[model samples]
Target: MKEIPEFQTERLFLRGITLEDTSSYQKHFVDYEVVRYLADHVPWPYPENGIEEFLKEYILPNQAMSLWMWGIFLKEKPTEVIGAIELCRKGKPENRGFWLGRKFWGKGLMTEAVAPITDYAFTKLGFEKLIFANAVGNIGSRRVKEKSGAKLIGTEPAKFVDPKFTEHELWELTKEDWSKP
Candidate 1:
């Protein structure tokens, strides 16, 4: 079995998800405010069985692929998971997804965590571009993507269960855009 790599940023440690972090992660997932803007699949009142399903079926089997889901920890409290970030493979390019507890919002922590991972995707992983998207009214998330240099491409109307929603905006960034000197 392959071991997932751990990464360090200026203020956060991006480490692989362990069996230990299930509870902490569930705390954030259960918050309606947090999952509101996420993809249609991440159900609100996140299923009690969801975390285990994620670990055994989704995360463990996909360990070999470029896709990885990480638990984001504060540098001072390295073992405590405060949020999550994942680089998901979406056909030709990769997609970026993240969430921080409501308390950590507006602190530039997400931006700090995203930059190195953005660099890792284009530089180390040999990917040409990265993509991000959020529900149309989700300005905070859009700001994080923009801060990382992703351009607003267009808006698309889509459907999601769980919370039962629709409509979203799309954004994207190329490695070339991020690599400019």
Candidate 2:
């Protein structure tokens, strides 16, 4: 299987998620505000063993199967995970999702972390296109997609952790377009 690649930005480092990251993951992800708009799959109150279970069941197996997932960390303090990002092979109006601690909001960190992964998806992984969607009111996520050069395709009902069904704006970025400039 292809090894998951590590990435770096001016201010952040993107590396494969690991069991050692559980404490930091739990520390930053337990905030309601940090996960409010994430998919329903995220346990609302984030169980005590949520990180452990997730790594053992989902992340490790998927990583072995060559899925792309990353733990987002600050360059100065790489041991602490501030957020997570993943590009899944799942079907439908979206295949990418991410969340950052409330403290990291508006820092443009996500946008920086996204660029290389978007390129890896298209240029390295050979996907024809990438799909992204954000809860209608998630302006921060929407901006990240836009900054990555994704085009707003339309809106669709999406499931979220708090509110089961939310209207999400779907967006798309094609490999062709991404290669243009």
Candidate 3:
């Protein structure tokens, strides 16, 4: 993977996640409201060392190899990790995944954060297109993709940390589509 570039949006900062971010990542992200929307593989009662283990085993090792991850923060509170966005070269039917702190919900933060990443994916990372997915009932996530010009290809059976979510929507955004006004 290319070096994970840091981004500064109008109100947020995006940087590669690191071990130093452990506490803040747990503080903001270890919540049911936030994790429920994620895939079923994530444990509900997230283990004490979950974040650290994840960074050490899954992220740090494969980073810059096949995966890229960025910790999301508000410029006003740059030290706190309020969310994360990830991109993987190999798709499990989708190339991206993300989650934001519940307190930051409905603020258009994710949409703002996604802009630069998507641009980098298409223009800088040589991705012809990006596939995104969200639980069928996740309106906020669904809207994020919709606003980004992703077209809904279809829905498929899936599972999330929250058992109620039984299906997921798959959306696609091509370089051609992203370049449009």
- TM per candidate comes to 0.89, 0.92, 0.96
Distance from true position, residue 134, model 3, in Å?
0.6
Best by lDDT: 3
lDDT of 1 by residue, 1-181 (tens): 3466788877889888876888887776667777776777667567787987787787867864857777899999887788988888773222877889888899888888787777877887777877777777778888887777788888877654334547667777898677321
- Give lDDT: candidate 3, residue 15: 94
Q: List where candidate 2 sits over 4 angstroms from the true fold.
A: 64-66, 179-181
In candidate 3, what residue range of length 10 has the lowest lDDT sum?
172-181
Candidate 2: pairs in clash: none
Number of clashes recorded per candidate: 0, 0, 0
| Model 1: per-residue Cα lDDT at residue 115 | 76
- After TM-score superposition, the amount by which residue 105's alpha carbon in candidate 3 deviates from its true location, in angstroms, is 0.6
Error at 153, model 3, angstroms: 0.3
Candidate 3, residues 137-161: lDDT per residue as tens digits? 9999999889888999999999999
Candidate 2 per-residue lDDT over residues 1-181, each given as its tens digit: 2358899888999998988999998998899887888878788778889888988787878882546779999999999999998888773457887888889999888888888888888877778989888889988998887777789999877788769448889988887666322
Off by over 4 Å in 3: 1-3, 179-181
The residue-level lDDT of candidate 2 at 46 comes to 80
